[model samples]
Target: MEQREGYKRELYKHWNKGLDAGDGCDTRREVIISEAIKAPVVTAGCKLTGGSWLSPYDGVTVSDAGKLDVDHMVPLAEVHDSGGYAWDAGRREAYANDQGSPSTLIAVTAKSNRSKSDKDPAQWLPPAADYRCTYAAEWTGTKLRWELAADEAERQALLALAGECPTTTVVYGTAP
Candidate 1:
């Protein structure tokens, strides 16, 4: 496959330029708020101080929102390599800030998010064994949502994972 020339993280304007919801919080904060198992207090500057969250990627419960990372299910670089290179700047930005789908942006432990990095199902699976099926399904669904294509290795990995978890289903909607 021919790799695209440009895939700098800057191409996709992540978290947006300013406050996205008129509140002080940005996209990342919004995701944190939505995913928190226990609602955290929003302070004067939209600082999230306390929250209990379950990082599905590692099955770790986190008490500090600061310890959580809002991860793109299909990490940005993987999205670029998976055909997002063809997307226009606006679409790229939208993809980066997408919150319409719960599966697209997940809140997980910082460690888990960093470890997974920009890897696809072919390269990485969640450390939590129970999340493997869901992760694969969400990864496939996110690719489909953005009209992105998966390479052969990723396809095979997802297929093999599907074979292992026959009951897991992928449900997705086209991104606007």
Candidate 2:
């Protein structure tokens, strides 16, 4: 595979461009509002004064939206490594802001998202034991949906994780 050479974070335009653009809230805040355990008050200009969300990554219930990070199931850097480097800016932006699948973009604790940054399944898995299976499934599904290629190590790790969750279903769409 040809390397992308220099992968810049700016290559993928995220947040502020997803669903309900007219709602005054950006993709990050919008995800927070939608995933809130307790609906938050959306004041003018999409300022989320109060709300709570469950970080499935660690089962941590966060009451403040500021502490949450809207994570991509597959990080942008990781996507570049997984063949997204070949995508045009438009497709890359669409992938970054994809809310079509709930798992595509999610709200998790900043700590968890940061810790999981740019790592593939082979390098890291969710810390929450119970969430590992689901994580693997979602990770796999996201790759499949985007027609992203996983390295051998990642494929092996996913296979092992899948064995643990035989009943877990991974529903993905065709190649884009």
Candidate 3:
């Protein structure tokens, strides 16, 4: 696949409160709520307080919502660099806030999520060694679901990681 040029995170709009109309929660909060180990106490306006979350990336358990981040499995800039630069604004928005599949967006510790910002498997992996297999599968599944292109190095890294996770399976449908 030909790589796109001039990729920018601004190309995709994210964290829209209205993405899921009438849900009252923005994309970030929704992810946190769904992934919470114990459901948080939500206010009438969808403000979340006091929740416990398990960060799959680092194997850390966090009870503070402030420490969690909603990570796009395929980061926005990576998506734009892959094929999203050509997508219409609505499609970009959908990709940014995609919650159709549990793998699309995830809740991780803010530290791990930032460390992974826009980097593919070729450049970054979870700090927790045991999570590598699941991470690779999720990464591949996200790329496949979004029809995103992976560079040769990224593909090879994913394949190698898959070898370590012989039983891990990826099941996904097309992106919106």
Candidate 4:
């Protein structure tokens, strides 16, 4: 894996009008709608007003769409460090706006998502301890699916977390 020294968030363009751009919704709104526990009311132009989201990271149930953020499971900076720096603009944009797979993006509380921003398992984990297993599995699956490489510390942390999650499993296809 490449060193994380000079990573720039701007390198990866995010929140593009996604695969369903024709619907006039961006990636964030699309994730919010998809992950909503209660279907959100979408006004014209895909403005979401009401929705309930179960944040898998902190295990919090959020009622307002404004309180949630669509998190990139493998953050853009981390992806760039792993292997995305070599990709062209089109691929990077696709990854940033990916909605083809459920694991690529998730709806979680804004607080939790910010807390986890761009940090790998070695640097951070969900505040909710019980969720670590699921978190680790998802992280691993995302990396494997995207062919991202983990550094030594990250690999160690993931291995340790996997030890605690004997029954947790992930199945992912090729990257978008």
The model with the greatest lDDT is: 1
> Model 4, residue 153: what's the lDDT?
95
Across 1-176, the per-residue lDDT of candidate 3 in tens digits comes to 63558776777888888456687988888889989998899998788898799999999999999889999988888888888888998999888888888898999999999999878998999999988888898888888998988889888999888888899998888887
lDDT of 2 by residue, 69-118 (tens): 99999899889988899999988988888878888889999999999988
The lDDT of each candidate is 0.89, 0.87, 0.87, 0.87
Candidate 1 regions with alpha-carbon error over 4 angstroms: 1-4, 17-20
Better of 2 and 4 by TM-score: 2
Give TM per candidate: 0.95, 0.95, 0.94, 0.94
Error of 4 at 91 (Å): 1.4
**Candidate 4 local lDDT, 149-168, one digit each (tens):** 89999999999998888999
CA RMSD of each candidate after superposition: 1.6, 1.4, 1.4, 1.3
Clashing residue pairs in all predictions, respectively, total 0, 1, 0, 0
Scored against the true structure, residue 170 in model 4 reaches a CA lDDT of: 78
The residue ranges of model 3 lying beyond 4 angstroms of the native Cα positions read 2-4, 18-20
From the highest lDDT down, the ranking of the candidates is 1, 2, 3, 4
